[model samples]
Target: MTRDEIFKGLNEVFQDVFDDSTLEVEEETTANDVDGWDSFAHITLIVSVEKKFGVKFSMGQVSSMKNVGTMASILLEKLA
Candidate 1:
């Protein structure tokens, strides 16, 4: 899928997990910017992304995902 499609899928997962449709997700967005996005939700988000994208995030990569832009960049490499 394209980057927009990938981000769209992630947005859906975000809305579902966060239980808030108003939460807009952008490449530069960060967990710190969003309320209720703790570690548990973070893992769930990672798993959901893996399932959606059919890819696995290395443990180091997972630990390094600080913001949505970083994630989008990594996803780009993984999907590429």
Candidate 2:
């Protein structure tokens, strides 16, 4: 999927995981930018994104991502 498409879906996952319907994610958005984005929430977000995209992220990939943009790039690469 294109980056825009991935971001659209990723936004939904983030909002859902955070229980905030109004949450909007930009390329630079990170856990620190969102309230309630603790470690448990991070795992939930990862699992939700994986299920939504039908993609599995390696531990390294998950740990290495710094922001939404990086996650979108990885998703695009895996989907490709």
Residue 77's C-alpha lDDT in candidate 1? Answer: 91
Q: What is the C-alpha lDDT of each candidate?
A: 0.86, 0.92
- CA RMSD of each candidate after superposition: 1.2, 0.6
Model 2 scores a C-alpha lDDT of: 0.92
User: What is candidate 1's lDDT per residue for 1-80, written digit by digit as tens?
Assistant: 57787788788888888999977799878888889898898999999888877899999999898888778778989998
Spell out the clash pairs found in candidate 1: none
lDDT of 2 by residue, 1-80 (tens): 78889989998998899889999999999889999999999999999999999999999999988998999989999999
Choose the strongest candidate by TM-score. 2
lDDT of 1: 0.86
lDDT of 2 at 13: 94
Off by over 4 Å in 2: none
